[model samples]
Target: MTSVSSPLQRLADALRKDTVGGFLLISAAVLALVLANSPAAGAYNAVREFVIGPSAPLHLDLSIGTWAADGLLAVFFFIVGAELKQEFVHGELRNPRRAVLPIVAAIGGMVVPALLFVAFNLAHPDKIGGWGIPMATDIAFALAVLAIVGRGLPPALRTFLLTLAIVDDLGAITVIAVFYTDDLSFLYLIGAVVLLAVFGYLQQGRGLAGALDRSALPNWVVYVPLAVVIWAFMHESGVHATIAGVAMGMLMRSSTRDGEHESPLHHAEHMLRPWAMGLALPIFALFSAGVSFSGFGTMLTDTVSLGIIVGLILGKLIGILGSAWLTTKLTAAELNPSLAWSDITGMSLLAGIGFTVSLLISELAYPAGTVLEHAKGGVLLASFTASVLASGILLRRSAHYRKKGVPAETAGRE
Candidate 1:
């Protein structure tokens, strides 16, 4: 007799599929758009702007939207950090020669977009602050699109896109920490660093292993409260609190100990990824993507919005594809054997789907008003356009590969 799967088990299995997470994200964004534009717009705005949290000591009180962007989204960044650590330690990023193409591509992807945004906003110098808006790629959205449309494509293409996006996230985080912070709190920042060091020590089993004589306590017992304290300190430091999550995730040991099945990093990634994708990200989209298009035509013409549109769609394509081609020519790096120029083109277009971090940066760049609305409008429009275009190209490529007898099951395996 076959054993029936529990509901939790079923949910876990579903979350493992890229398509499920992608669909949930798209659904949430669409629902938010509908609510924002309909008669319920006031209710939507009220819910998003509602504030809670303690105001003393840490001054954690913030609007619901702020909580979504700063608190919940940190979980997403933790996963990004874990994936980055995995890639650096054991995956594609381990080989410098193999890594050069994606690394250069990621750099080009960020630089060209910023340049294009700057060029678009040159007449309005004040609007140039929004250049970072187009530099991010929403890995969840892009991977979901690939899962839907890129069946039968080579696994290497997916790996290329993942590595490229991971690097892209790192660049975007650096921009946030460096350019966007309003005030610096050295004491709180120093405290955060010290705690991070302690967290790293525990992750390597150095701190706890000796204390318990090798029978360590549960991870939640030790790490969860410590993580919260670190996040609190980081938040008080005036740096974006999401940076704390990334730092802690990176601190986790990626290498497995003897007799262990997987490293602490991978284990944490496995447990937290579902929450990040299913709950944190969807809630973030609900609050952040509720842009109203009442003045849609004007927003399209605005310099900031126009810059974002051009940067995300045209700039990402040119930067990523051009840099990859140039790298193949100028260096010893070569394209993956399973991929072609057309596949790279499709991947470049898909990288234009900058949703999550784009919205977060929009908030950081502009205060509540028409300008922020227009920036978000640009992100949503560009992301939709990129998804459609990428689907067309990738679907065609998938069909071509299918006809060539490539197995669809191997599409995203690596």
Candidate 2:
């Protein structure tokens, strides 16, 4: 056999790499930015506006771009759901005591951000509803930042931060399902359950201990049937359809310790990661992140805009830092392993970077309007600043460890 060309090697290589998610996500964001700012911006709008006719047999309608939110995001959620289950069972959140710090931190991170948003908007009662805007941490974006600057931090410390972000994502998904659902239809849910149950039974027959055994949710099965069922039902139900992603993901099995083929979780994550990041997310970003900056002068003054800004910045800082300290104090839970107070503080700041999830909440809260744009701007500004500061601190900490010959794995969780 002939050796592959370098370019082909890169493409084939990305197909299975863990960092592939980051590559796809960043590329999409970049593409979105270019199209939005380029002379061909009208083309970008046109693509999103394109329609995908007849979702159900009844010929219910959906738009091409909107479909990403309703359809593809569900797959994304499924992978996330599977990951959450795995974490609860075997990963960083493996035990309750071990899980407490991140959970407390996540709770604080969410609550504090919302309160800050409320603080900004409470004076204007109409803006009160947007309090949830700051309550999420975009795991992909958060991890990307960490990966970029993560070398400065010890491996264990970096892993801890990533784990916290993942746990935080689970909370965001719950909030999306519980608080963000628009309309409910029990009949559709019944249809979804039947489909999922069929999926579960078929897979359960294989007798894997956990479902996250592969890159996609199910090792031996295709998710299309289950996804179609969930999409239809979730669309009909009050919940955001992306919740279907988490649901479908939870159905799969787990990977073996030696990283053998097709653990359900790995299989699921593999299948969804690129589509979520590359195709679906790019489609999503072009539509969702496409706020017209030219309207800033008039729009910035809107109470909604101001509220989103305040909520993300102040809220995230208080929620993340305060919660960690309080949890340690009350539970006497240990702080992360081998981490000094300074390092913990630095990582806490990184938790404030709220790009991906903030955008999602904005979409859920406002769909399309000045409010969404304002929230996007707020996320970009605050998360950027926080990430920069956090990077500097974390980088310095890494240098200290390097000089002292400290190993990264020593950075422990309580």
Candidate 3:
């Protein structure tokens, strides 16, 4: 670890120690499903559709579900952005040599899954918008499973999976901003750019730091209003408002003085990670994961649904594993000696757990109705299947290492 004490790294360590965050997310999703299926279905529907704001100048009036997706989810994206910036500035991404393998694998993971989705949806042009649905890796769920099942694996394996996921998230965000946007609003876009620039400038300079209380400078005076303005303008720009979080995060300064104080980016990530995992993400899951069992049969049989499933499960497996193997063979790079080929294989399988972003993209791709319901069902089922398979492999591998009193590297060789 660097002397500066990156908050992103601290947050990751904290999350790794506390696996309950992933379970809470799963519980929220399961509870939503139960509510949607039982006699409470009507009440669940009402709650989801309940409106709570005036529809006017801001157009902020939105359903409970929309609020979860657009508003709460932006917080989650902000955390991701901050963590990404930290990684680029002070973490593994700063080194091209260290980053190349995971970056290549992540790109392969995305492209193959999308191609597989397109394969299934090519005939159905109406559903083609969803090709990006399966190209995601839910880091929380995947890492939780690995932490529990692959604890005996080398630590490097975790770093590999985390790096790949970061890249995977960046890809998903790009796809959302580029492929799923609506009517253009360049005026708002330009204004958003200027606001973001101002925010960046303020963050970079320390002239105003002495004017405010040390604690209030980053959170109150600099970030709050600028973030709001950026988000509002981003929303009006016909782009998903979540992108504002990513943009702001990337622009945040990660390098700090004295190797003791946290950078503004690190501070933001630390503060937001808990909120994102505990509140924002779980709320998003509760609102988005409720798919009526009415579409269960159709989702299993539908081409669009099958596309999502195959893309996530099989495409991710082949893409990540194949690309990783190819990278090692093509270059001097080798799998981390602390890890095993089996570890990579298991991690690749876990990458198929594309619950969060998959559901979000499904919503953007399909309108409210049966098609959307079926897509949600597919995402749930596919994520469950991936989790089960990955757990089985990882647990077996962990046991193998534990019994031998050695890392899986030697075990795999034997």
Q: Give all candidate RMSDs, comma-separated.
A: 3.0, 4.7, 5.3
Error of 1 at 239 (Å): 3.1
Among all candidates shown, the one with the greatest TM-score: 1
Clashes of each: 0, 45, 0
Write the candidate numbers in order of decreasing TM-score.
1, 3, 2
Q: Model 2, range 1-414, lDDT digits (tens) per residue?
A: 667677655564564343565556556666776777788788887887788777666234777666766666565566667766676676655756646776677788788877777777877775576677777776656655566565645554555565677667767766776777655567777777787776666555345533433445653455565567667776676555665666666666564555556665776576556556556555555565453344456556777766665655566667777787877788866565666767766777787777666777777777576666766776666676777888787777777777677667675332
- How much does candidate 3 score in TM-score? 0.82
Model 2 segments more than 4 A misplaced: 2-10, 15-20, 57-60, 152-181, 206-223, 255-262, 267-287, 298-303, 338-347, 355-357, 360-373, 398-405, 412-414
> By TM-score, is 1 or 3 better?
1
> Candidate 3: which stretches are off by over 4 Å?
1-17, 54-56, 121-129, 147-152, 206-219, 258-260, 331-337, 367-370, 400-414
lDDT for each residue of candidate 3 in 1-414, tens digit (9 for 90 to 100)? 475668766665565343556776778888998999999999999999999865776677889998887778788778767866776677655766656777788999999999999999888999888999999998766776786677677666677887798789878977887887666678888999999888887676466743432454445665787798798888777666777887888898787754438777777787777778778878987987777778787677788889989999999999999998899899865665566778778888899999878988888899998889888888888888998999998888788788889855444532
| Pairs of residues clashing in candidate 3 | none
